[model samples]
Target: MRRIVRTLCSVIFILHGLSVGQVKTGADLLFEKYAHLVEGKRIGLVTNHSALLSNGKHLVDAISESRRARLVALFGPEHGVRGDAPAGKKIIDARDEKTGVPVYSLYGQINKPTPEMLKDVDVLLFDILDVGVRFYTFESTMSLAMEAAAEMGIPYIVLDRPNPIRGTWVEGFIRLDSLRSFVGLYPIPVAHGLTMGELATMINNEGWLKNGVRADLKVVKMEGWKRTMWFDETGVRWVKPSPNIAGLATAVVYPGTCFFEGTNVSEGRGTDRPFETIGAPFVAGEQLARELQSYGLPGVVFEPIKFTPRDIPGAASNPKHKSIECGGVFVKVVDRNVYEPVRTGIAMLSALKKLYPNDFQWRNSIDRLSGTPMVRLRIDAGEKPENIVAAWKVELAGFGKLREKYLLY
Candidate 1:
């Protein structure tokens, strides 16, 4: 019995060593190195399903087990604390099962942490997953949280996460001032390839926080993370941060196909496979695929497919959900590096417009999603995809400079 126990201990040590030798995430770095900063302080955590440890433990659970950092309260983003809520729904406060701590809902009636929410905590910690798209609600939620933290004079600590989409590449146009919405409150391109920590640093440095407001802000940087490494390379498990985004493939195509949300076409909601499947009632998938093949978008293939949308159980029934059904195309990506998601998406939109002018309609709300009227307006005016993209090069270059100052790793 003694010999068997010793062998088990030895195996455990080896596994521990292997985990330590792997690349450290921002959460790992914070727990291992900078946890002292929050020692003895009343910390409030704002996080969701993505706030995970290297070994698949939630940060809340890890903090509860730690000797340092007394976690007082929890906060949920758009998807609620447990991340089970559908998009655009209100989250309510609840007790965490493992820690039994109070979890407040920031995405409810108010978008920011109120004074009441901050009263019991000295430091506000933010750790959530981000897909590296500008219009994702997580970015907006972070911005709002930063503002509230600054207003309350509490320190904001962001446990960084990889940008899933990688940081080395920059694409798309900078949002024009006229198109700002809750979806896009800042002037970033459709795909701003910075990690959450880098984004926090950039926003703080860029004067997004009011000049007079004061808050201590710090980012726990990730070790062994490179700008070019995609999420698959990080050896981190992918959790579905939102209902639609299920896997790395969904994330890779999201920057482009997400634009379909602003159109009459289906962005593949109400189906087993979302974002990966796209279509509309009027779309001739085969014809569209043939046309797209001629454009040579690089590293991606459009396969014509048909799908019937089903209701998500327990999801709120609305007019949009009354027996939802959509038809369109499936995007099969061969090489992420060679694929230009934004440009390909643009071409798809343009081709659909030409093929079915009457059936294809850009929802009036498109300006808010794309961050400008240009994408829809240009397509409506019969401009080619290449020319429409060319118009934004100057603005994109300017935003690139601004994006550089805030990169943390």
Candidate 2:
């Protein structure tokens, strides 16, 4: 966290007083600054449905209609351009329905843009909303795009947006190089605090790109935004970055609960309250909730819940524990500032393990999702969540220092 963020702990940062009214996104300020602008360039855009202006017009449309940039082709991330695909589903190349621009799928066989994909492009524009979780593949897509742009020697511009979970709270483990995967690419913590722009700068400056390469990275900084402001405080309408992440509350609990995806438990994927809730058919919801309540974790409470995950088409195709009523817990964040999402998640796992030693299952993916092998190993050895969290302090603090150099706000 920055000194200003720590100093102003008492002040509730919002889009007032310090800021005029609302957060003006980088796209919002496009017309203001014309230096290296996309007004008359061939641009290959990497964006999704959430890249919209305050007026409710999508950036893709606004860019095309403004006649500013000749959108040569479109690049779809993990969920495709319109956010229609399910998690981990591959997207095929197609043409944009509205603009007739050739759409390239970067989430499937082609993890990065090919030379042919960049042959006709002068620059690549990236604009996507991130929910501030490491496992979310948006940042990985952007990193690959940057690498492609660098290899092709084209300038890369990032249209910045607010980190919905704010930019001051850095938590969880710095991913080990051994655990590298599409879900956990860069060595960032689970709830990394930087926005897209700042992370891009870090990715470039820290030489984290392919073969220690670099990009001509340019980040359009958000105006009237601060490191302390959460999405709700920005007065900007929330857009679901992906299918399951539908609300701010879900995002708040996601950094922790999303680990459930690694196990047989459903992380509320097919429920109306995804990420905020987690369960499996074998869980005793009320008993688990009662056990968690005794922990008295800060800024959060767990409530017993019962739900049957649905196999909703387009949203969740074959959800975990599909169509089965499961005992669960709802993570309600009361004061996000004090909440430790990673710890809460670890505590939840600990409670489950202690309560049902034989019933609870620990899948291998837990180590991958957790970014290190220690978390799972320690939990399996009956180590308390606090002790596990305390063990991560040295590495987490080191990452915090390295992260400070790239912060924009």
Candidate 3:
């Protein structure tokens, strides 16, 4: 009886130890261990609705209710502070009802905070959940805010979070300097595998900020996060970073399917499964699926699917092919570990162009979306997807080496 009791106690102790090893976001660490950094300082937080604590409280509410820190102002990114605004919609400045603090819009008349906007701010804090894609726009917002913080002579702090996709897998072409836009700013690859904190560090150290200005940046890193762990594996609750990115599965295929946005095709917008479903009015679902499957793309499968686009208020209000039934393939990633998003997108484009030579057309946005005209040019010239993907190997290799200095986890 004594031996059995001792064995039971040991098992309980081991179970508790395992639970303690779960990943904690930088926001969790901020309050638990780094409260002194913000204590007594007037803070201006650049964040959206996705910033939440492990306890499931929004960051805005936590900061407003905190006695140690004074939340003097709030800055919102592309989406409004609450993350309700749709893509490309201009957000207007207003006062936050809950905190009764002034909320400045960074997405409207300006993409960066003016010096006047930061005159009352002593420190700037950034805490938004970002899906690790170059075209996602959050990084651009973060970089622009960092520039503003630098000009204002205020310290910028980033409460780091896990890169929803694994941080070890970097792929795709590096954006050309000539084709730089909000979607493909700087010279990073389409699928940059760095967390927001790591990307901020790179932007600062690499002098990517405007006029080569660097912010006094400090990153409160996460605890127990690994480069190989996806968001679901991190034990952090999933908040839709943007309206379309509903779950971890959506994020997995987003890197590849997002390319369709540059074409005449409906990239599964205005539907229940945005990025997972890809089709245009002209596409034959079975044929597209069969073609995609023939490529033997790793860790993914395609199934014939037909969907109709509709206006989703906060997500895709005026998405492509609204109210029209489209035929396309549903991309199901079976194993994210081996799946390559950018390459898969290239393959899909190649197949589409071949199957519908007359109907398939490349929009001008392709150059900006792809970060280079070569992707559009090559596919138009009947180049195989393999050759096109292999063309970027050298540049991608060089970028991999440069990114090593900025990797946090």
Candidate 4:
């Protein structure tokens, strides 16, 4: 009986704690209990537009109104695939106006998946929605489409979700393998709290794919996710997974004001509070909100705002101080269980480099969004953001013991 009414709706939300519609995703248990593992085959999916379900539909319209899998071709990542492309635009390969299918562009100029884009496919789903930062490029477009479905041997799967900032809070700094890139390619931690099916089983058991190939992977997990629930305590509705993560309180201060996108300010991208509105144009907003509210940081609070940046077409077209104005501060959180978004983004980059030391700049893309350069050479030697967050506590305790060997929940 639908697995005993989903195990009594997970034991009445673990003894009457029913927070919202009761979580279930992983494309809602892959059409409820792995629809015979993609029933007749030929899938492809690697989706976008926040891949929903639980009746709201859109897992590419339930695998193009499935009988049981046949969705051949359609990929997109980094906005596109009905997600309203904006951040760094560039997606092209069109078609899918409503299942005309054939839509490629793994964020343009190809980012993997090309054996003739998986020659009519067989199995390779993903399902997006991941603001669990680590330079959020949808987990590097899901580890380069699991190394192109392990070089087209197919069977990749992944549909899991919910790490919307709460997988038991692991924090920043650890990208160092010569600063990998594509935002960060691995050695984990810019808040790497797993859950894209435990980071694709820790990028396929830590070999970190490519030239170590693997992907026969499968991960349809999520059923009342819990590595400390958040995503509004899981009821699964907020859909804005990109185009400026506009909800879940700007995704819990986006891994710390997304390090003001490596600087030159305006991390609030073209207004309407993009990363909770930090600012620039030679800031002042009540003395930078009283110097980030005298750093008593803990679950946030900062105010003095100003705003301006325009061209909001499909959300921030020319961002970073586009039509100017700035002056910043708004951050507000108020206790997301002691909100430590990368220590409030390294104390707002050490209070904007100690109150604008001649208008702070630093932009070599902030060491690939701080995957290292020791957090921009220890914040340019002025250190102390708690000793640069205690020099990465023994590499986040050996990545919490190699992330407890690929946690599934």
Candidate 5:
């Protein structure tokens, strides 16, 4: 019996080893190739839990141990320096324990680093994990940091990480200039399908930087990463960068269902599986799932399920402040390659409207969330989801052409 048990354990270990051998992330590539770039230089790092060495040590600790980079100030984004602050909350400056370096909060009083913040550092390094969606807020924070670095004439380095949503496919509407917000500061689609480093390059060349703010920018490119590979393919461990984005499944459905945040519906924020589960007070889960299934969307399946919103970490959890119990279907994406997130989200909204005309109403704040009122307006006017999606094709194609110039493997 002991021999049989040992054999079973061995099989499990082997399976785990096989899974970890598949793909490498941008963070993995950076540490392997260019750990010496910041050696001896006082470095300021804008990163969080996603940045780590291959042996599972945080990059801050690893760099401190290395003879190369002199780890100085640690910068945090929306979730704070340690990635513990709730989304959109202000992050306070503190000290890191592993390295005892001062940690600065970029999500607080200043979205960009002041000249004071960069005073001690000779070089600025950025290495945050990004979801391939527009409204995630991390990209915006990165952009702001770049702008600050450019303004200060500091050498900026972006340690590349894989676009977990992959880099080959682009989707959603091209954000109009007037519609820009903290969620989307530039004219890009909802899912830009580029790495943080690639987006930084595009922003620099496109003249998004303030006039006279010239930055000596360098991107440490990833090794053995493909634009088509998904996060699961990348053998690296999945760390939850933000609270709601629990795993790869959540990231897969996020680009589509995240729009629900601008509405009265729950995007599963109060539950254990946010983004992967979504519902509204008026939704009939089984019926809605059936209708969605009839559309035959590729790479996905709809499971009609019911969930009551409960307060969870990284999400707003007050019952009195929150709306009624959500009752929508859960989207199980069977295939990522053929699944279109933006279209699926729009279809879901449309279906809700048709299914319960009296109860379904677009929240006025949706315009801010979508970067424009057009999506909300069209849905209200009884426009077909396909037609609404079709209207953005020309603009999306134009963005795609422009995006081609900045892509780096």
Candidate 6:
């Protein structure tokens, strides 16, 4: 027991040391470490606009210009190749005017690459920034692509990226298999604390891929990254991973506030502050803000404000209750380490429901976002926020153990 405790302490100390050092992403080391894999081969990349090297060159242009490698095609996730499309918007198959490589839509009529899409490719590479939430579709896209590649006997490589939420915090309920949607494809926690590379290994090894598909997987890892280091700590520039996630501060609050989407409230959508603000036309902003303060949620503070959502394509294209006057609370993350996003979300949700029992409603969509119908059921059943959170402790603890086998850092 003493040995185990000491080992854990040493690992934590090493992780902290790494936060202060300059880190190089997986793509930065590609030419030096694994040029042999891509050199002279027709490669397919599953990536989006957020992917960037430490030196700030986009991977598509880098690989296209590389004399050693031939860029064959591109596969886009929920967003288009350039990541300009909005959520759930169908992306048309188009040509990359920059590289002239045919861009296939993995998020449209076809969710995975057909045999026709893979015939000319020797290996498929997946590299995208993940915000470390289960509902984010990029990880699902990566797993699906891996399955397709596995079935076709093609090699799949994940160019590891940092989990922008930092890898030290894992929270929320484990998803139920019956509730798997594109939003929640696997039975993982909402705030899963793993990098893309680590998640790829877990999904593949744990048989979470479609039909238990076994991937011929390889992960090219980052240098000097630790699970404890957040995106800002990594010394790499932050690119908006998606249209709504505008900054690292927004990403910090997303895991919890995102649940508002499954309800009648506007989750700061259509506003300049998506995910950081929660509002509804029925809310009393000042009173709600005071109530939130009474909860004394750690690592965050709430301010009552009013805003109207605008119709901006790709950002808040058609947000709930758009253009309606909404009295809401804006969240400011002061200290990420102590802010329990899932718990905060649950507490706020509970308070709102209590405050407006007749006005607040949970849509069926909550099951997919929350991972189970039980969370919503428990909340409506008049359970305390702490108890609702506590119900998942056993499973969350079990998942932490299961996740250990696949961690790279």
RMSD of 3: 2.8
- List the global CA lDDT of all models: 0.81, 0.88, 0.91, 0.84, 0.80, 0.89
User: What does candidate 1 score in Cα RMSD to the true structure?
Assistant: 5.0
Candidate 1 regions off by >4 Å? 1-21, 210-214, 314-325
- Candidate 6: 10-residue stretch with minimal lDDT: 16-25
Residue 275 lDDT, candidate 1, scale 0-100: 77
* TM-score, one value per model: 0.91, 0.94, 0.95, 0.35, 0.91, 0.94
Please write out the lDDT profile of model 3 over residues 1-409, one tens digit for every residue.
9999999999998886565346899999999999989999998999999999989999988988999999999999887899999888999999998889899999888989999989999999999998899999889889899999998889999999999998887888999999988887799998889999999999999998888988999999999998888887777888999888999999988888888889999888799999999998999999999998999999999999889999998899888888988999999999888999889999999999999999988888888888889999999999999999999887898999999999887
> What TM-score would you give candidate 4 relative to the actual structure?
0.35
Candidate numbers sorted by lDDT from highest down: 3, 6, 2, 4, 1, 5
Which candidate has the highest lDDT of all? Answer: 3
In candidate 2, which residue pairs clash?
none
Model 6 has an lDDT value of: 0.89
The window of 10 residues in a row where model 3 has the poorest summed lDDT is 13-22
> Which residue pairs overlap in candidate 4's backbone?
none
> Sorted by TM-score, highest first, which candidate order results?
3, 6, 2, 1, 5, 4
Each model's backbone clash number: 1, 0, 0, 0, 5, 0
lDDT of candidate 1 over 59-99, digit per residue (tens): 88888788787889998888887788887788888899879
- The residue pairs in collision within model 3 are none
Task: Give the lDDT of residue 83 in candidate 4.
Answer: 88
- Least accurate stretch of 10 residues (summed lDDT) in model 5? 314-323
Q: Of 1 and 5, which scores higher on lDDT?
A: 1
- The candidate, 3 or 6, that scores higher on TM-score is 3
Candidate 2: tens digits of C-alpha lDDT, residues 1-409:
7988866864655324454348889877765674357868998999999998888889888877776678898999988999989988999999999999999999999989999999999989999999888888999999999999999899999999999988987888888999999888889989899999998899899998989989999999988898888898886768999988888888888889988877777788888888887888889899999999999899998889999998877788878888899998999898988998988999998888888888888788898789998888898899988998898777888888898888888
> How close to the true structure is residue 166 of candidate 1, measured as C-alpha lDDT?
83
The ten-residue window of minimal lDDT in model 2 covers: 12-21
